[model samples]
Target chain A: MLCLIAWVVFGILGLFSVKYRVLAKESFDCVFRRITFKKCNSNLDERIKSKLTGNLMKFSPKMARGVYRHYEFLSWIFVALFVVSLVLGAQGAYNLAMYDNCAGPNADPDQCIFTPDYDVVDCDDPLCDDGHCEECGDDCDCEECS
Target chain B: MMNVEKIRKDFPIFEKKKFIYFDNACMPLRPKVVIDKINEYYTEYPACAGRSYHDFGTRLTDEVANARDLVKKFIGAKKAKEIIFTKNATESINLVANSFKFNSVLTSDREHNSNLLPWQKFDHDVVKSKKDFSFDLESFSDKVKNFDIVSMVHTSNLEGYSLPVKEIIKIAHEQGAKVLLDGAQSVPHKEINVRKLDVDFLAFSGHKMLGPNGVGVLYGKEELLDGMKPFILGGETVSDSTYDSYKLEELPHKFEAGLQNYPGILGLGSAAKYLMKIGRNNIEKHENMLKSKIDIEGVEKIGHVGESGIFNFNIPGKGAHEVAMMLSASKNIMIRSGAHCMHSWFNSRNLEGSARASFYLYNTLEEIDTFVEELEKIKKL
Candidate 1:
């Protein structure tokens, strides 16, 4: 399952460095075997797990033990998190394209980076002059203003 | 006792990097003298050893001869001519396997792939190890009479347990069988005298003994080497040639074919000299002392932590490679993992593999402490 994340991370890193390319290929093989219901003969998962746990052992033995013991579970959790993020990102992109806001229609524009900055105007207010709200000083174009 | 600190100074790797190197069984770190010797060959006299008449060639030929003589002396061979240079111990064993006439061959079950693979072509049988993983001498004694040649590893790389070669050779000889000892692991760690052992042949690599790679020695009794034909033939192997037939050179030359690894050979000679200066007995003692300090609980040890420098073990429920990698990642402690080319032994036992940490002369007690500390932390995992 760690190979799932490794495949994506190392795949991108592989494009820039030769060293990561070898690891990327190994992780790719691991992920491929995993999805095909075969064992990962490449041992990429074990290598990553050990390397991570080993480094952790230097600072905290208890933490290292926990990590080593639950490496597979942790890998699954990370993979799940990655999948969730991917799905959310895709949904956000869809909402931004359809309703002009990543959080969907009637949501705050501040919630989405792609949402264009615009002034909030109340066309029915008395403060609205020339069909433009007061808050929309220079860059506002309400229906009445148009 | 060897001054570990002073000895560490000889190897330039120590100066360049800080890591506890425990993979001596795979290959020991090269010392500055060996490196300088190799560099000297490339810088001073980089020419064909035997074929050329120029000064560079003549000098190289002398250096190559000197290296052979050093190797012969190192192994206590009767004559320098008995020493034949090859790429490594594997090639040396292959040369013997190809050239030596034998109806049947016998080997120990704990042979490295190098010693085991070559004899697969012949009528080969393996002597099973004892319950404690020691050499089964009684089993070997019973099997010797049925075989023409007894090929065995002198010192096991898996655990560093040296087979009783002196006794094994005597038994093999009594049964009218010749012996070929794979000294790849033994020759580097301890002193081996072929004449004293009365062994017919011995093969070992130079890289394992603080030398450069791509050079190895095959020491055969002169009479046996004389009876056998050359395994490989080319430029330097022949004295004279005809349109119809060719006459092969004598002894070592016939066995060593083509242009040789001159720099590696010279470096190996320097390595031999370096080992001699340090003393093999000192190395063996220092390693034993270091091995004695390894006291970790809750982990299963592979072999008896005996007099040798190797310590093989596995943390329960943890993969051998995982433990080894963790140790490296935690403290930069280098060790060998997996079956160590002895897959037959591990497979027969139904074991995945064992992590092996082998010590050498330069290895200190402090390093052993760090290794133990790391193992204890890993054992919890």
Candidate 2:
């Protein structure tokens, strides 16, 4: 597990040193601004009497600064959100994997985090307390047997 | 008094949608102060903190130091050096979990994965978390003496039922067990007085408390922090080094191993300052007011609006993942569904699962009404 973390950390460190900037794809011409082309993965439209949408942007030679920036801002926002969500996902999963123990002396061997599948309480205990294992009787107690 | 509309204007997200972003229980949205703070760091003072001697480095160091001081005042930590910035609440817990040595750590199921897993991973025995999803007093009384440390979540990430930290800390003190509170879910929704709580350690993430992500806090009691091991080591964390042996830097410096996220740290300080300026009491009152308005049309939709945030709940019978996909497909409204990272706590119970819609101070009552109203359509699925 430590090996995996070290590998990931190494990978991230390598990424930081690499000097590169990536950009998104865009239409080849200004006329294409009114349209975004999506290749339909489907063979037929299922019913083809459809006129394609030319979702045109109104020509605003003079628009409010904030309004004009909002579209550009949104495009960047989408990019930022996408990247951040990706980064945060990695950080979260890493934290979970790194902190992979709840198997101490105070822990019920049954409730150890690594064993995410384990039933918290014995099914046959007297109380059979649904959530709280402490409320259970000695039914799941294999400690003495061990 | 903090005006909702005034605060709302600073967060452009409110202008974008129905805007009932109540899941501050998970992460708080960033404000202009935090956003500007981060932008300033990147644009003006982009430098590695504590790792260089140049002017840019010194400027970064001063900003981070000032941010740390702000953290000290925010949490009422005895000293600024006790504050260690981490990625999130989970990372903070992992840092605290791995840093300290104790025979065993006592924790409850009420804790988020951040608090539970790290302590759990220390190869320590985890006592059964209390019933009713609240801290069991008897459990603490019976168990603290048997363990070397105690960890707790200040509140349940799900229900927002608060634990008595002051009382829990007192009990742990009596038993010589160190207490650490997972303050991530609780802090942004409410103010924290770490000194008054008297917990040996407290872990919190900034995103959940009106700050940016990639920044969190570990506030340790001065003496315990002095004794605990550092989270990561290298670079600025070291005072002097040789191939054979190296000396560690002092307090917080020794703990922050690499080029820590200076921008996030600054954002975190600003977030705390913003929350403080607004006052904790008002924030709590505002959130609870929204939460109190959660309504049900019938038994069917009740399953849809399970409990908290618009996107932070699991729909029963329907696979959480499927509902999440559907919600995103039909509407641009974003949400998280399914067993959050605390799947173990949920798996422990016989109950199936629920949908959540956690509330925050910035959310308007009108938004809540709109969400509850729109959620009525969700049951149709």
Candidate 3:
């Protein structure tokens, strides 16, 4: 549980630092090794797992033997989730950098983006009586603005 | 008494997920409305409160003040001015310990570290809990007379054993000692009436009660707060200041120094509203119902499973941490293990720790049954 929590945190921090991204990738590698039943070289994952589940050994040797086998599956699942989160968070940050906001295409631009005048952003039609464009007016389809 | 399905729908964490959360003692899952409120702040009006006179600043100030009022009502405080917002319960307790005037302090063995370390600066005496996980009231009574302040945990996170605070407060008052209730566990799970308890100070964390992290409450009596010194000092806490002479602001404002957490406080206000709408009495009843029928084979209970949502136990021969880990890995179940920050209680009894599963309003009977089934599998392991 502690290991997964750390990975999730590091994954979030990976957004700001490449060093954290490296650490998260190493952690993910450890999880991947467990999934493939490879000879794991990373002692950090094993140490964390042992320290966390150490109480079980004292509680009952039998229970420890039974449940320890499943730790690998949990590690894999957590790493997978961390990867997804890191990818989506990066994508959002990328979108926000390129555009003023990272809102979904279907999202209302008024609520998602900041602007002094809504009229300028929404005015898609060249023809306008007042500053508001009639095509993108109250009954406008609103797709052309996006 | 609450509609479980309807209540669960309010929380987005449950959406598109079949996972069960029993970590309420650590941090409760936030509701969608609270998340929406947070997002709304950053998107629409991201401005500092009490620092500007513009439209955005005025709206932010009102939101912060409104949040303080909501917290005051939630804990049954005498006035809104009595509520001081801090980062968490640890900060709140530290604030009272550092600010209050006291020569000696009294606490108990079952206290979390937040309630313990803050008093170590003074001549502190600790009353131990009995072997059965109950507080030794006689020890408390004998020690109360020697201390000027009685700081205590309202409920033990280890066993969910609630201290007899009303009677304890009466005894402390008779001995001319002011009391501080560590309401971290009690405030979220039970209804807290500071006015009725008559405690001088009450501290609790918002995250443990379905609100955002990094936001908590330190509620003091209006008079006591006025008398106590400020914990943190900077821009927001001062009215007027010079090189050598400075004047602090009144009540809550004096304690809340620096830029405040406006979004988090708004989230907490929403959490308070959510809890109130469901009714605290109903939550208590539902949790009690869940605690009563908790069935497990060959597990040893650490403390009395009273009228609380907390359950602490160990597999007869299985280590508590092992059980917690195995359950999480195999079933995605989350339960707390270890000393639970009550090292004094566990070390005194020659025990390491017990596995703890805490429930909240969002928890269901189905989750408990699933937990027991997983426990059965761990027994085979």
Candidate 4:
């Protein structure tokens, strides 16, 4: 699970650079295979885990052994946190679009909230004068706004 | 203020397992932040310290120095120079037992081998612990005048019983004997002000706490360290080395002796800061509260739970190893069993070892309930 999340994090990083794109593609393929009941490249997972935890051997051999033993369990946690972060970011965006606030219902009107378009606008301001938000203009593309 | 749920969130291990982690006495799980700090070293500055004149090297040196200062503060040392980083507590104890010239060394029977075995090199005697698992302080005080150094564990690893270190140190000092505290079990669980404790030397490992492994600290008084010879000698430990003789470096470097675990040291600094910010009193309180929730009467028990969050118990008609294995296999509950590195102490008593459930700040009462529930099944098994 940790390997999968690490691959995802690496993949997101890979999106920014052409150098890591091939590695990310191969890693994603492995992840997809494992999840979809195909003959996944287990070696790819091992490679990613070693890449992540190999330096730990110098740090402490005992700890390195533990990391290898628990890599599957750790990956699940990493994936869960990644998912949680995605949900939180999405919820924050949702609240901003629907309620014109990131703190959801009881948001302080004086506080500036971030919108989906990366614009920070005060909650007290009239966000949508008509059917569109003033801060995001026509590009205020969000779940509630769309 | 001590929210177990919120605290558990900081430790990623909770989300990774269905088990209640009661093996904290061996190694507490690291928080995500501590892991990030270690990763920061690898990602940002993976350079060697005290060797290269490069920007990364210089920065790494400063970071290591900062960690030293933080550790000094964590243990309440009078100066940062007093803290010496080693591989682990075993190395730290060996450093003192080897370097410090003493006619005879004194130690308790209940010390972890890290503390107990090091005394083999020198003339040493073991003071026994009472049947209640507490140290026989009277025996220690009686023998204090005989030894030049009285080295003892501040806390017992097997029983989790705390020794009367303050009182023992006083008696040892009065007898002109230097005291070294094996603080591996004590430092992570409670606040220890070395100056207040007035111990001559204190040794502990970072992994026992919520820090990375491969880094341990031996804190001695500046004067005591200055007087003692360096255990390991050569490179980075000398200011100048002639063909014939070498001028040793200052207090800590003289002891460090080689290229140290820079990343581990930095992570340890972060761990110390994290624990301090949470306040040791509060961590102790949380562990105490969790201890109160454990129902040990239903399970076959050996000794009462100590103030520190450790319960050592035996199951009737079951080997400790079998009980530990069954617990892990059946319910996924993790614990430590057997002698716990105090083999001499256990052997002397002519008894088989017991299963140990040691808790940390991240443990919850609900988890304790799960542990008890599983132990009940293991008993039936």
RMSD of each: 4.9, 28.2, 17.0, 18.7
How many pairs in model 1 have backbone atoms within 3 A of each other, for residues 3 or more apart or on separate chains, i.e. clashes? 0
CAPRI-wise, candidate 4 is incorrect
Q: Compute the lDDT of residue B258 as modeled in candidate 4.
A: 76
Candidate 1 residue lDDT tens string, B1-381 = 688889998888898888999999999999999999999998999999988889999999999999999998899999999999999999999999999999899999899999999999999999998888888899999999999999999999988899999999999999999999999999988988899999999999999999889999999999999999987888878999998788999988999898899999999999999998888988988888899899988988896446888999888888899989998999999999999999988998899899999999999989999999998888767
State, as a TM-score between 0 and 1, how close model 1 is to the true structure. Answer: 0.92
lDDT of 3 by residue, B331-353 (tens): 67888888888887788789989
On lDDT, the leading prediction is 1
Please write out the lDDT profile of model 2 over residues B152-236, one tens digit for every residue.
8786666666777888889889988888888877777677888888888888888887788888888887788788778688877
Q: Which residue segments of model 1 deviate by more than 4 Å?
A: A36-38, A95-110, A116-146
Better of 2 and 4 by TM-score: 4
Sliding window of 10 residues with minimal summed lDDT for model 1 chain A: A137-146
Tens digits of per-residue lDDT for model 4 on A2-121? Answer: 446656767888989876777677777877887887866545665555544434543554665576568788778878888999898898877887877776858774453463335543
Better by DockQ, candidate 4 or 3: 3
Could you say which candidate leads in TM-score?
A: 1
Q: Candidate 3: where are CA atoms >4 Å away?
A: A1-146
Runs of candidate 2 exceeding 4 Å displacement: A1-146, B16-19, B51-53, B121-131, B297-333
Interface RMSD of each: 0.6, 14.5, 7.9, 14.2
C-alpha lDDT values of all predictions: 0.91, 0.64, 0.81, 0.80
Candidates sorted by TM-score, descending order? 1, 3, 4, 2
